[model samples]
Target: MDALKILIIPGSARDGSFNRRLAEFAARQARAAGQEATLLDLRALNLPLYDADLEALSGVPAGALRLQQAIQASDAVLLVTPEYNGFPTPLVINAFDWLSRIPATQEQPAGLAVTANKPAGLLSASPGAGGALRSMNFLRQYLQMAFAMVVVPQQFALGRAHEAFDATGALQDPRAVQSVETVLQSLARLAQALKTA
Candidate 1:
Protein backbone atom coordinates (compact mmCIF):
# COMPACT_ATOMS: atom_id res chain seq x y z
CA MET A 1 0.00 0.00 0.00
CA ASP A 2 1.10 3.56 -0.59
CA ALA A 3 1.90 5.96 2.21
CA LEU A 4 -1.17 7.76 3.55
CA LYS A 5 -1.18 11.55 3.50
CA ILE A 6 -2.29 12.64 6.97
CA LEU A 7 -3.17 16.14 8.09
CA ILE A 8 -2.79 16.74 11.81
CA ILE A 9 -4.86 19.58 13.23
CA PRO A 10 -4.56 20.69 16.83
CA GLY A 11 -7.61 22.45 18.25
CA SER A 12 -5.72 24.70 20.63
CA ALA A 13 -3.52 27.61 19.54
CA ARG A 14 -1.98 28.42 22.90
CA ASP A 15 1.81 28.64 23.11
CA GLY A 16 2.12 25.70 25.49
CA SER A 17 -0.88 23.58 24.57
CA PHE A 18 -0.75 19.89 25.36
CA ASN A 19 -2.88 19.12 22.33
CA ARG A 20 -0.34 20.89 20.14
CA ARG A 21 2.45 18.76 21.55
CA LEU A 22 0.40 15.65 20.91
CA ALA A 23 -0.26 16.72 17.34
CA GLU A 24 3.45 17.27 16.74
CA PHE A 25 4.25 13.89 18.26
CA ALA A 26 1.64 12.21 16.08
CA ALA A 27 3.12 13.87 13.00
CA ARG A 28 6.57 12.52 13.85
CA GLN A 29 5.20 9.06 14.44
CA ALA A 30 3.32 9.05 11.16
CA ARG A 31 6.47 10.06 9.30
CA ALA A 32 8.51 7.41 11.07
CA ALA A 33 5.96 4.84 9.94
CA GLY A 34 6.47 5.92 6.32
CA GLN A 35 3.39 8.09 6.11
CA GLU A 36 3.23 11.73 5.04
CA ALA A 37 2.04 13.99 7.85
CA THR A 38 1.62 17.73 8.06
CA LEU A 39 0.96 19.59 11.31
CA LEU A 40 -1.49 22.44 10.69
CA ASP A 41 -1.04 25.47 12.92
CA LEU A 42 -4.41 27.19 13.38
CA ARG A 43 -2.71 30.26 14.83
CA ALA A 44 -0.83 30.72 11.57
CA LEU A 45 -4.07 30.47 9.64
CA ASN A 46 -5.55 33.35 11.67
CA LEU A 47 -9.10 32.47 10.74
CA PRO A 48 -11.77 34.95 11.66
CA LEU A 49 -14.92 34.18 13.59
CA TYR A 50 -17.62 32.57 11.53
CA ASP A 51 -20.02 35.34 10.66
CA ALA A 52 -22.60 34.95 7.92
CA ASP A 53 -22.46 38.67 7.31
CA LEU A 54 -18.75 38.45 6.63
CA GLU A 55 -19.35 35.51 4.29
CA ALA A 56 -22.03 37.43 2.42
CA LEU A 57 -19.76 40.42 2.03
CA SER A 58 -16.27 38.84 1.59
CA GLY A 59 -16.92 35.16 0.92
CA VAL A 60 -14.93 32.50 2.70
CA PRO A 61 -11.62 33.71 4.02
CA ALA A 62 -8.33 32.69 2.42
CA GLY A 63 -7.59 30.60 5.50
CA ALA A 64 -10.72 28.53 4.98
CA LEU A 65 -9.88 28.08 1.33
CA ARG A 66 -6.43 26.88 2.30
CA LEU A 67 -7.96 24.54 4.87
CA GLN A 68 -10.29 23.08 2.25
CA GLN A 69 -7.42 22.57 -0.16
CA ALA A 70 -5.38 20.88 2.55
CA ILE A 71 -8.19 18.48 3.40
CA GLN A 72 -8.82 17.80 -0.26
CA ALA A 73 -5.17 16.85 -0.69
CA SER A 74 -4.98 14.54 2.32
CA ASP A 75 -5.97 10.88 2.49
CA ALA A 76 -6.94 11.25 6.15
CA VAL A 77 -7.04 13.68 9.06
CA LEU A 78 -6.00 13.44 12.69
CA LEU A 79 -7.76 15.93 14.94
CA VAL A 80 -6.01 16.51 18.27
CA THR A 81 -8.52 18.47 20.28
CA PRO A 82 -8.46 20.07 23.72
CA GLU A 83 -11.53 20.31 25.90
CA TYR A 84 -12.62 23.81 26.79
CA ASN A 85 -15.27 23.14 29.44
CA GLY A 86 -16.32 19.89 27.75
CA PHE A 87 -16.33 21.36 24.26
CA PRO A 88 -13.84 21.75 21.47
CA THR A 89 -12.08 25.09 21.28
CA PRO A 90 -13.95 27.85 19.52
CA LEU A 91 -11.08 28.44 17.12
CA VAL A 92 -11.31 25.03 15.52
CA ILE A 93 -15.09 25.21 15.43
CA ASN A 94 -14.92 28.59 13.73
CA ALA A 95 -12.48 27.30 11.18
CA PHE A 96 -14.82 24.47 10.25
CA ASP A 97 -17.79 26.79 10.15
CA TRP A 98 -16.00 28.82 7.51
CA LEU A 99 -15.01 25.73 5.60
CA SER A 100 -18.62 24.48 5.48
CA ARG A 101 -19.84 27.73 3.95
CA ILE A 102 -17.64 27.55 0.88
CA PRO A 103 -19.91 26.97 -2.11
CA ALA A 104 -19.42 24.19 -4.61
CA THR A 105 -17.70 25.02 -7.89
CA GLN A 106 -17.32 23.27 -11.22
CA GLU A 107 -14.13 21.67 -9.92
CA GLN A 108 -15.79 20.49 -6.76
CA PRO A 109 -18.73 18.11 -6.87
CA ALA A 110 -20.28 19.25 -3.60
CA GLY A 111 -20.04 22.00 -0.98
CA LEU A 112 -18.51 19.51 1.43
CA ALA A 113 -16.36 17.84 -1.23
CA VAL A 114 -13.20 18.36 0.74
CA THR A 115 -14.49 16.62 3.85
CA ALA A 116 -17.06 14.06 2.74
CA ASN A 117 -15.98 10.45 2.99
CA LYS A 118 -12.55 11.42 4.25
CA PRO A 119 -11.11 9.14 6.90
CA ALA A 120 -10.56 10.83 10.25
CA GLY A 121 -8.78 9.89 13.45
CA LEU A 122 -9.77 11.53 16.71
CA LEU A 123 -7.47 12.17 19.66
CA SER A 124 -7.45 14.45 22.64
CA ALA A 125 -5.24 15.54 25.55
CA SER A 126 -5.80 17.30 28.87
CA PRO A 127 -4.25 17.71 32.28
CA GLY A 128 -7.48 16.46 33.83
CA ALA A 129 -8.67 12.88 33.97
CA GLY A 130 -11.19 13.33 31.17
CA GLY A 131 -8.29 14.02 28.80
CA ALA A 132 -10.52 16.21 26.64
CA LEU A 133 -12.48 13.15 25.68
CA ARG A 134 -15.75 15.07 25.74
CA SER A 135 -14.48 17.38 23.04
CA MET A 136 -13.31 14.43 21.02
CA ASN A 137 -16.72 12.82 21.26
CA PHE A 138 -18.40 15.95 20.05
CA LEU A 139 -15.97 16.32 17.18
CA ARG A 140 -16.36 12.71 16.14
CA GLN A 141 -20.11 13.03 15.98
CA TYR A 142 -20.00 16.37 14.20
CA LEU A 143 -17.47 15.30 11.61
CA GLN A 144 -19.20 12.05 10.86
CA MET A 145 -22.80 13.25 10.88
CA ALA A 146 -22.42 16.77 9.60
CA PHE A 147 -19.69 16.28 7.00
CA ALA A 148 -20.07 12.56 6.29
CA MET A 149 -16.46 11.91 7.19
CA VAL A 150 -15.58 8.35 8.08
CA VAL A 151 -13.86 8.39 11.46
CA VAL A 152 -11.82 5.47 12.63
CA PRO A 153 -13.28 3.73 15.65
CA GLN A 154 -9.98 3.53 17.45
CA GLN A 155 -9.21 6.67 19.39
CA PHE A 156 -6.91 7.84 22.20
CA ALA A 157 -7.17 10.29 25.05
CA LEU A 158 -4.04 11.39 26.82
CA GLY A 159 -4.89 12.12 30.42
CA ARG A 160 -2.65 14.21 32.64
CA ALA A 161 -1.15 15.51 29.44
CA HIS A 162 0.81 18.13 31.33
CA GLU A 163 3.17 15.33 32.29
CA ALA A 164 2.56 13.02 29.35
CA PHE A 165 5.38 14.34 27.23
CA ASP A 166 9.06 14.67 28.01
CA ALA A 167 11.40 17.64 27.43
CA THR A 168 11.92 16.31 23.90
CA GLY A 169 8.14 16.34 23.23
CA ALA A 170 8.05 12.58 22.97
CA LEU A 171 5.40 10.67 24.92
CA GLN A 172 6.82 9.60 28.30
CA ASP A 173 4.64 6.61 29.06
CA PRO A 174 5.04 3.43 27.03
CA ARG A 175 1.28 2.79 27.22
CA ALA A 176 0.48 6.20 25.90
CA VAL A 177 2.90 5.62 23.04
CA GLN A 178 1.18 2.35 22.25
CA SER A 179 -2.26 3.96 22.31
CA VAL A 180 -1.24 6.65 19.86
CA GLU A 181 0.41 4.13 17.59
CA THR A 182 -2.73 2.03 17.60
CA VAL A 183 -4.94 4.93 16.60
CA LEU A 184 -2.61 5.96 13.77
CA GLN A 185 -2.38 2.43 12.46
CA SER A 186 -6.15 2.07 12.43
CA LEU A 187 -6.54 5.39 10.68
CA ALA A 188 -4.04 4.49 7.99
CA ARG A 189 -5.64 1.15 7.39
CA LEU A 190 -9.08 2.71 7.10
CA ALA A 191 -7.89 5.41 4.72
CA GLN A 192 -6.18 2.91 2.47
CA ALA A 193 -9.17 0.61 2.44
CA LEU A 194 -11.64 3.38 1.75
CA LYS A 195 -9.49 4.74 -1.06
CA THR A 196 -9.34 1.34 -2.71
CA ALA A 197 -13.04 0.74 -2.18
Candidate 2:
Protein backbone atom coordinates (compact mmCIF):
# COMPACT_ATOMS: atom_id res chain seq x y z
CA MET A 1 0.00 0.00 0.00
CA ASP A 2 1.18 3.53 -0.72
CA ALA A 3 1.71 6.02 2.08
CA LEU A 4 -1.20 8.36 2.57
CA LYS A 5 -0.88 12.11 3.09
CA ILE A 6 -2.70 13.19 6.23
CA LEU A 7 -3.29 16.70 7.51
CA ILE A 8 -3.60 17.21 11.26
CA ILE A 9 -5.29 20.44 12.26
CA PRO A 10 -5.38 21.66 15.85
CA GLY A 11 -8.37 23.84 16.59
CA SER A 12 -6.92 25.71 19.53
CA ALA A 13 -4.79 28.84 19.30
CA ARG A 14 -3.54 28.90 22.87
CA ASP A 15 0.00 28.02 23.75
CA GLY A 16 0.45 24.64 25.44
CA SER A 17 -3.05 23.60 24.41
CA PHE A 18 -3.93 19.98 25.06
CA ASN A 19 -5.62 19.72 21.68
CA ARG A 20 -2.40 20.82 19.97
CA ARG A 21 -0.50 18.21 21.92
CA LEU A 22 -2.94 15.57 20.83
CA ALA A 23 -2.61 16.69 17.20
CA GLU A 24 1.17 16.48 17.41
CA PHE A 25 0.92 13.02 18.90
CA ALA A 26 -1.39 11.91 16.11
CA ALA A 27 0.98 13.31 13.47
CA ARG A 28 3.89 11.41 15.01
CA GLN A 29 1.89 8.22 15.04
CA ALA A 30 0.84 8.68 11.40
CA ARG A 31 4.47 9.09 10.36
CA ALA A 32 5.47 6.04 12.39
CA ALA A 33 2.77 4.12 10.53
CA GLY A 34 4.52 5.11 7.27
CA GLN A 35 2.10 7.90 6.36
CA GLU A 36 3.04 11.47 5.49
CA ALA A 37 1.54 13.89 7.99
CA THR A 38 1.39 17.66 8.13
CA LEU A 39 0.44 19.34 11.40
CA LEU A 40 -1.25 22.73 10.86
CA ASP A 41 -1.44 25.23 13.69
CA LEU A 42 -4.51 27.41 13.19
CA ARG A 43 -3.12 30.17 15.39
CA ALA A 44 -0.18 30.62 13.09
CA LEU A 45 -2.48 31.02 10.15
CA ASN A 46 -3.71 34.38 11.53
CA LEU A 47 -6.87 34.28 9.47
CA PRO A 48 -9.30 37.13 9.65
CA LEU A 49 -12.83 36.55 10.91
CA TYR A 50 -15.15 35.43 8.11
CA ASP A 51 -17.34 38.27 6.88
CA ALA A 52 -19.22 38.38 3.61
CA ASP A 53 -18.81 42.14 3.39
CA LEU A 54 -15.08 41.88 3.98
CA GLU A 55 -14.77 39.11 1.41
CA ALA A 56 -16.71 41.14 -1.11
CA LEU A 57 -14.26 43.98 -0.56
CA SER A 58 -10.89 42.25 -0.06
CA GLY A 59 -11.50 38.70 -1.19
CA VAL A 60 -10.33 35.61 0.73
CA PRO A 61 -7.24 36.34 2.74
CA ALA A 62 -3.91 34.80 1.75
CA GLY A 63 -3.82 32.79 4.95
CA ALA A 64 -7.19 31.23 4.24
CA LEU A 65 -6.15 30.49 0.66
CA ARG A 66 -3.05 28.72 1.89
CA LEU A 67 -5.15 26.65 4.27
CA GLN A 68 -7.54 25.74 1.48
CA GLN A 69 -4.65 24.64 -0.70
CA ALA A 70 -3.28 22.50 2.09
CA ILE A 71 -6.64 20.81 2.56
CA GLN A 72 -6.96 20.23 -1.16
CA ALA A 73 -3.53 18.64 -1.36
CA SER A 74 -4.05 16.22 1.52
CA ASP A 75 -5.56 12.77 1.18
CA ALA A 76 -7.20 13.04 4.61
CA VAL A 77 -7.77 15.46 7.46
CA LEU A 78 -7.82 14.92 11.22
CA LEU A 79 -9.34 17.65 13.33
CA VAL A 80 -8.05 17.81 16.90
CA THR A 81 -10.49 20.09 18.60
CA PRO A 82 -10.78 21.64 22.05
CA GLU A 83 -14.22 22.07 23.54
CA TYR A 84 -15.50 25.30 24.96
CA ASN A 85 -18.97 25.32 26.50
CA GLY A 86 -20.09 22.16 24.68
CA PHE A 87 -18.93 23.34 21.24
CA PRO A 88 -15.81 23.63 19.19
CA THR A 89 -13.58 26.65 19.75
CA PRO A 90 -14.38 29.75 17.69
CA LEU A 91 -11.01 29.43 16.03
CA VAL A 92 -12.00 26.13 14.49
CA ILE A 93 -15.46 27.33 13.42
CA ASN A 94 -14.12 30.56 12.00
CA ALA A 95 -11.50 28.80 9.97
CA PHE A 96 -14.08 26.52 8.43
CA ASP A 97 -16.44 29.41 7.83
CA TRP A 98 -13.81 30.96 5.62
CA LEU A 99 -13.02 27.64 4.00
CA SER A 100 -16.67 27.07 3.12
CA ARG A 101 -16.91 30.06 0.83
CA ILE A 102 -17.49 29.25 -2.82
CA PRO A 103 -14.73 30.40 -5.05
CA ALA A 104 -15.36 32.42 -8.21
CA THR A 105 -14.89 29.48 -10.56
CA GLN A 106 -16.90 27.03 -12.65
CA GLU A 107 -14.72 23.93 -12.54
CA GLN A 108 -15.82 23.06 -8.98
CA PRO A 109 -18.60 24.77 -7.08
CA ALA A 110 -17.39 26.87 -4.15
CA GLY A 111 -15.90 24.71 -1.35
CA LEU A 112 -16.09 21.52 -3.38
CA ALA A 113 -12.36 21.50 -4.10
CA VAL A 114 -11.54 21.50 -0.44
CA THR A 115 -14.33 19.45 1.12
CA ALA A 116 -16.29 17.32 -1.32
CA ASN A 117 -15.56 13.63 -0.87
CA LYS A 118 -12.45 14.37 1.19
CA PRO A 119 -11.76 11.89 3.99
CA ALA A 120 -11.78 13.36 7.49
CA GLY A 121 -11.45 12.16 11.10
CA LEU A 122 -12.62 13.86 14.26
CA LEU A 123 -11.03 13.80 17.70
CA SER A 124 -11.22 16.02 20.76
CA ALA A 125 -9.41 16.78 24.04
CA SER A 126 -10.50 18.63 27.13
CA PRO A 127 -9.63 18.89 30.79
CA GLY A 128 -13.12 17.67 31.71
CA ALA A 129 -14.52 14.17 31.88
CA GLY A 130 -16.38 14.43 28.58
CA GLY A 131 -13.15 15.00 26.68
CA ALA A 132 -14.80 17.45 24.29
CA LEU A 133 -17.09 14.75 22.92
CA ARG A 134 -19.93 17.22 22.56
CA SER A 135 -17.71 19.50 20.55
CA MET A 136 -16.70 16.66 18.26
CA ASN A 137 -20.35 15.92 17.57
CA PHE A 138 -20.94 19.43 16.33
CA LEU A 139 -17.75 19.44 14.31
CA ARG A 140 -18.63 16.11 12.73
CA GLN A 141 -22.01 17.41 11.66
CA TYR A 142 -20.45 20.50 10.14
CA LEU A 143 -17.92 18.44 8.20
CA GLN A 144 -20.63 16.17 6.90
CA MET A 145 -22.57 19.18 5.71
CA ALA A 146 -19.50 20.43 3.92
CA PHE A 147 -19.42 17.11 2.04
CA ALA A 148 -16.37 15.57 3.68
CA MET A 149 -16.20 11.79 3.88
CA VAL A 150 -16.01 11.30 7.62
CA VAL A 151 -15.06 7.62 7.67
CA VAL A 152 -14.55 6.80 11.34
CA PRO A 153 -17.63 6.16 13.46
CA GLN A 154 -15.42 5.36 16.44
CA GLN A 155 -14.21 8.86 17.31
CA PHE A 156 -11.55 9.30 20.00
CA ALA A 157 -12.00 11.79 22.80
CA LEU A 158 -9.36 12.29 25.47
CA GLY A 159 -11.14 12.82 28.74
CA ARG A 160 -9.51 14.39 31.77
CA ALA A 161 -6.90 15.38 29.27
CA HIS A 162 -4.64 16.95 31.85
CA GLU A 163 -3.99 13.61 33.47
CA ALA A 164 -3.87 11.65 30.25
CA PHE A 165 -0.48 13.00 29.28
CA ASP A 166 2.89 12.99 31.05
CA ALA A 167 5.73 15.50 31.52
CA THR A 168 7.10 14.44 28.18
CA GLY A 169 3.76 15.19 26.52
CA ALA A 170 3.17 11.56 25.60
CA LEU A 171 -0.12 9.96 26.56
CA GLN A 172 0.58 8.23 29.86
CA ASP A 173 -2.15 5.62 29.74
CA PRO A 174 -1.54 2.58 27.57
CA ARG A 175 -5.20 2.32 26.63
CA ALA A 176 -5.36 5.95 25.61
CA VAL A 177 -2.27 5.53 23.49
CA GLN A 178 -3.75 2.47 21.87
CA SER A 179 -6.97 4.26 21.09
CA VAL A 180 -5.17 7.14 19.40
CA GLU A 181 -3.04 4.81 17.37
CA THR A 182 -6.08 2.86 16.31
CA VAL A 183 -7.93 5.93 15.11
CA LEU A 184 -4.94 7.19 13.11
CA GLN A 185 -4.37 3.78 11.60
CA SER A 186 -8.00 3.67 10.56
CA LEU A 187 -7.73 7.07 8.93
CA ALA A 188 -4.65 6.06 6.94
CA ARG A 189 -6.21 2.82 5.82
CA LEU A 190 -9.36 4.57 4.68
CA ALA A 191 -7.41 7.26 2.88
CA GLN A 192 -5.39 4.62 1.03
CA ALA A 193 -8.54 2.79 0.07
CA LEU A 194 -10.12 5.98 -1.25
CA LYS A 195 -6.97 6.91 -3.16
CA THR A 196 -7.00 3.63 -5.05
CA ALA A 197 -10.72 3.46 -5.52
The model with the greatest TM-score is 1
Global lDDT of each model?
0.91, 0.84
7-31: candidate 1 lDDT, tens digit per residue:
9999998899999999999999999
The digit string of per-residue lDDT tens for model 2 on 142-182 reads: 88876565657768999999888888788999988888988
True lDDT of residue 121, candidate 2: 89
Per-residue lDDT for 37 in model 1?
Answer: 100
Clash numbers, per candidate: 0, 1
lDDT of 1 at 197: 89
Index of the highest-lDDT prediction: 1
Task: Compute the lDDT of residue 149 as modeled in candidate 1.
Answer: 93
- For residue 151, what is the lDDT in candidate 1? 93
